[model samples]
Target chain A: MKHIKTLNTRSLQESMKKGGCGECQTSCQ
Target chain B: MVHQYRNNGYNIVLDVDSGSVHVVDDLVYDVIAFLKDDLSKADDAVTARFAGRYSPEEVSEALEEIRALEKNHQLFSRDIYRDAVLDFRNHPTVVKALCLHVAHDCNLACRYCFAQEGEYHGVRALMSYETGKAALDYLVSHSGNRRNLEVDFFGGEPLMNFEVVRKLTAYGRELEKMHDKHFRFTLTTNGVLLDENIMDFCNREMDNVVLSLDGRKEIHDKMRPSRNGKGSYDLIVPKFQKFAKQRKELGKQYYVRGTFTHYNLDFARDVLHFADLGFDQISIEPVVAPADAPYAIRPEDLGTIKEQYDLLAQEMIRREKEGRGFTFFHFMIDLTGGPCVYKRLSGCGSGTEYLAVTPWGDLYPCHQFVGNEEFLLGNVTEGVKRSDLVSIFKSCNVYARKECRDCFARYYCSGGCAANSWNFHQRIDSVYEIGCELERKRVESALMIKAALAD
Candidate 1:
């Protein structure tokens, strides 16, 4: 298995997901 | 669950529970699918499944590699936060950001504006300094232990009440000093009343400025026009360009934000147009409107929209290779450290940790919910009046969202927008399927771009 990126592995309490802030939903707000 | 997909000639496997991403060979990818949730059957499955394709030695090697990753606690990680998330949701949170509607009025009429040209389904008015000051005070007082606070000057046009914005900012600074807090100010403007003084002040005081200009001249003009029925593109574009340039030079953050409606299915061109116009930081998003609206994105447009994202991603990679890469807001993925686990599950602290204050100092869950009276939390002078509403918002998490429970992008989008769900299904816990589809595509495209750049 070739690891690409593992942002968090220590604990689920500190996990960081693979996307940025979905600010797209804040359209014209 | 390990969600695997192929994009741009790369096989990607995402361990949903652990937030681990892997790029593996076709044999390992297929082996993972066969193994599914049972690691005990990995040896038997790998050998039997790939008998005709991969040799015994290659299958054994791939199986060992998979076992090594699993041993490292990177694959098949259990959902440790599943139960804790419920506790996290119930815990009281202090307000960290306020989207202050400084003016419920706008100079230009944006046809797709959710705020109904800034009046928010109410009378057009500017927020008084007293009201803004009270809003700041409320933020400072309620923000326990959190040293940094955010205040966004949002409106039909914040510049209409520019003086109030200036005063509120000054007052916010003073409150920060007194309360030992730091205020990060942001301004979202339509750019009609953006003058030299405003630009200078924003550069000096505002941490980020969001300038609205919807793509090309014709597209933007058709959607955004003045009360006198004149297009606003010619007036706003030059100002926005100048503002963006100065922000770039000063090392401040700003973006030329736009919206894409059904009128522009070829939205990729508009994104390229923004890039060509010399604005590096940009965001062009799908417009959220009622399905019956003439410009609303219909179900049939999904295919075109997803294609646009793919096209935009490919072009962005090309630009990066040419050393002229611009940051697309949605495409930015922080590999080192993204938002914390709580943020990933609970989403943007919309109603709980972040609230929107209207011109009259009344609070709502967020700016999008301003006009809806049922969502009124309370005025600044009086604290959040409806604790029940707060509880309801607190319950909004990825786990609580039925549609998001099985979605692979659930952690990324955090169950999509609550306001949007409420608008569409009248249930905050539901999901907007269209937004979900687009979000998934964007995530895939972003990962593909990352892979290309890494190569």
Candidate 2:
């Protein structure tokens, strides 16, 4: 919360949901 | 056109073109919004708006602050692309990650599989070594001035074609030395065919391994049973646990992911279940299927999902207080260092930046479109012959979508997934409402959790 500056809504969704693509991180399942 | 949102005594503004965000306090918030509403409005009118509470001198001082923000280009919306990246569209494309469908054949039959049970609606076959090599070459050559290149050995199960996977990792490494590019590999598996040999090889060669273990045993077995109709949890748990331990020791990247549907509306329990199992990195999401699909999270169930997210947040906080906190992938969004406003506005570079190559050397936008030839860009052999489709997605920024400009969370979500749009609305620019609602709920929950933690 220390001045949360970034706001990537789609990445937030991908981080939560596993659309079966893993490249987002190294990235997904 | 700068837009504003007031939350928790902080003002958050979005400059659509520049993708700049500024967090200011009450007085400054008013000053920014006042000028944004009508920059030409006389200072006397602004004094009347904040009348009695603030004197004219204070309004005049606030005007000074407004000018400062305007000077910084944070108060007004204007195209900053030329200054930021300098003709990004015309810039060479960089293939950072290539999802290679090593085996078109899958061993399990997940009821909700968008890949047509892993065969991708095609004949069951594995990628010939020739195709796999060509795809890797395609990834390397097309990757413009990028040092970090990634390959996801995806399939019905990547383990199905372990030999090619083994061969490709070595081949990719060889290419890395020749091309001076670093190749990072990932293996996404259902974990049915995992063995000591495969695990050992993966631990040594792979950068990250995405093991699919739906949170709860019962729910997973029900949704993702093997061809012989038996629970995979029993077979996968020990191996997955072993890998998790190794990942922790090596500081490697890995996540145990699951999907929650209409059936598991109380999905927070699944998050707890994973934590209890001693897994630290966890991500759970709703299934991306159509509304009419039997297991879709319908409108009525949204409230329940929201409640579950809230409950999960509380549990995470409680565990942290008790010194057992874990990283829930969604809950750890640090906006300060996230992607720039433009990237967030357009979402991931799926079709344009990332390409999924089938075992037969065919290329689709991403893995989701592998079987759907309508999205087929071309084969790896042909090299993206469809510039028309490529331009369509390349031009798909959130501003281009009419509905996104008015959305407060639009800066974060962009315009949702293109594949999802195509599946749900038959077009790339259309939004997927279910995914959008779920995203909004998750973003809300994340902000609430961040606020609580800050407190």
Candidate 3:
């Protein structure tokens, strides 16, 4: 009956990264 | 695919491929689930399906909203990264990170150490300056246009080879200016030899330092002890507390990393223990060991572990409200600005961009795969000899693993740790089922925390 919010509209894979591992799963064992 | 779940009294719908999350009312939640299952049915059938509970008007409105979201490409979005992933290996392989095991020797004797007390199933040795320099040179040469490079000084304990760590860092800093590249150094230590001098140097140089402390004196001392079987908690706690405070004063980052095994299923208390100790950045992870090992987290522990995650998230929300918020590594998520498609599909870049170098300069995919001779890529001096193996590692993605293909947390974890998969199944493109379950729960708890705090 109701839509509260849309957290993200853009496709996450479409973004660009400048540097750093960017993000690919790490809490470094 | 839409993965719907309720947590912290909120119904969350995650459109897997598109990475879009929708928080909806109960009626809309049911309507979306219905539409996902039978998309061919007309709007009338959808309304009739839920007619008993929700009014026809409510169903109609929910359908309209879903349709609008679909039109806007926010719901039920198609996979656009499939083609990109299929040709993943063809892309240039650039080495950007190195887990330099400076010392294949440890000062502590942790019971569940995967590295076998730091020797990593090999002879105990310290990396010579020449070998460490060669590693830095190899990384720079193979980096291929990546300006920001990460070098984690890992080992049985990096501090055991403090002189070598310092030398390698200085060498890396020198190379950075000449090559127009920046080095981000991280050190993961057991905090056994931590002192004022080392702490000062770490605050000045290391970008991030991971201090190992298993929390709660009883739990920590039992798991992580010295060569003489003496508890290290008494020796390390005061040092860690001072180090954490100094890092905060210098505006640097550090984490008090801990490991919780089956012996302590109530790991949430340990996480709180870190918070109460005035350490802000904390991470208490589930210990990874053979399933038969007494300390290993078994299949039966899944339910209790998930509950602990929920409890931790709720407590995190409470702490934030009380102005005592601290960052829990696993609970952090960047829904809006997450990884790019390349990073998401490829994963942590173990064998490709990131590789591990042993003290004697032997190379492996990562630290976890170091001891396994089968995973040896080559030596740092020779560079990666197994380009075919490198290609295989490069090809590993969410789609490569069958279970990961359908897993809701696939993109979030990027097929989980390849080493973990290889350890269990002898295959990189596989799933660690237990880890998968815990990851899903953590993701849900993270989202719930975000929602609760937003309120």
Candidate 4:
């Protein structure tokens, strides 16, 4: 619900800059 | 029971009752067509059995079976999809070269160096010998015999810690011997400490060397002076000339990079000074403001940099056409022509195909965040497996960031550097900071103008 709520008002651009729901933060290397 | 019928090109009927639903859509028509088309009698019987019966429970069971079949189909189809995508990937491998910061400590302290953070001098935390070995090992092991390997050595001043560089170079040579792989090596330096030994090393082993020269004597000296408050240009120019002479004699490639801060923006005449230095390849980079730095660009100053860039690009193009070549350190043309891949704007390759190891044996997404604790991927002591790295890569899709999806320059910029994106905007796929955006726009516009003029 919180993520959905955030998605509702936040521009897709803003959400993307947040690195896509914290997915980019994970250490892949 | 209620019967609902829907048709597009074919007719289908759904009948719902107390515990069963029937779908009798096109069964008779299908049987008639099959029979008319000379279908085998056995096949016709099979079709006819299902044709008249469309009970909800029966249909539900059939649908469940179909769903299970579809799942299996998809599981197998992924291989086919990957194969199709592989064709695109195979056309030309994206150049994902890195200028590894084999050494971080610099000989001189520039006033505007980003590595300086309130007593947290980043230069001192140089990559150790062990760290360099680990990084090289990682690169050699994971590269999977990738045909083209271009490596650049970066630093506060890479020469400040030349011993580690020597070790890495030796390791690289050993790896090459084992794998029979060839690599290109280049060094970017401030040029103050370059001497015969360095020149000899570069001539024999390296492909290209780039020197950081801000511009004319006054500007260069003012911006990049010695820590003892003395001008560096005068001290370094003679050494640069010697290096140039050696490069000419040795037939080695060399480039000069000029970084422009706000202080130098007002002066365009200083650019011509680089031309006088007998250096042909000149690169101009705008002063990049850190995450905490103020975000304001003077319109006039930006215009000045643009004007100089246009003039330089035009001159370089003209000279190149005349068979008298001059190099400008802009990668847009190389990127567009598919000769080089810029990691920053190209895509998120770090932690996916590329990874950086810190001096302390900690893995990172890339070298840009070498000392930053937040960026630590894993420790060497833990001995992370290859499969673990692969899963980590799959999970972190920087391109999926909503901001990146929506940005107009997403294709070109690739959400800028992922590390910068995470640190500054707190998102990996976010648009670059305002200053970066402006600088990129200026460079992009200049490149477009150059391309058009050449055309």
Q: Which candidate is the best by DockQ?
A: 3
CA shift of B341, model 4, Å: 9.9
Question: Which digits, one per residue and each the tens of the lDDT, describe model 3 over residues B258-338?
Answer: 999999999999999999999999999998888889999999998999999989998999999999999998997788767
Per-prediction interface RMSD in Å: 6.6, 9.7, 4.0, 21.5
Where is model 1 more than 4 Å wrong at Cα? A1-29
By DockQ rank, best first, the candidates go 3, 1, 2, 4
Give the clash count for each candidate: 0, 10, 0, 14
Winner on TM-score (2 vs 3): 3
Q: What DockQ does candidate 1 score?
A: 0.21
Against the true structure, whose TM-score is highest? 3
lDDT of 4 by residue, B130-216 (tens): 877776665555555464455667766778777887778887888788877666677878887787888888888888888877888
Chain A TM-scores for all candidates read 0.20, 0.21, 0.19, 0.30
**Candidate 3, after superposition: displacement of residue B54 in Å?**
2.0
Q: Which stretches of candidate 3 lie over 4 Å from their true place?
A: A16-29
Query: Against the true structure, what is model 2's DockQ?
Result: 0.08
Q: Name the candidate that leads on lDDT.
A: 3
Off by over 4 Å in 4: A1-29, B1-100, B117-128, B248-251, B267-270, B291-301, B317-325, B331-336, B339-348, B379-412, B433-455
lDDT of each: 0.84, 0.75, 0.85, 0.52
TM-score list, all predictions: 0.95, 0.83, 0.96, 0.63
Q: What DockQ does each listed candidate score?
A: 0.21, 0.08, 0.39, 0.03
What is the fnat value (0 to 1) for candidate 4?
0.01
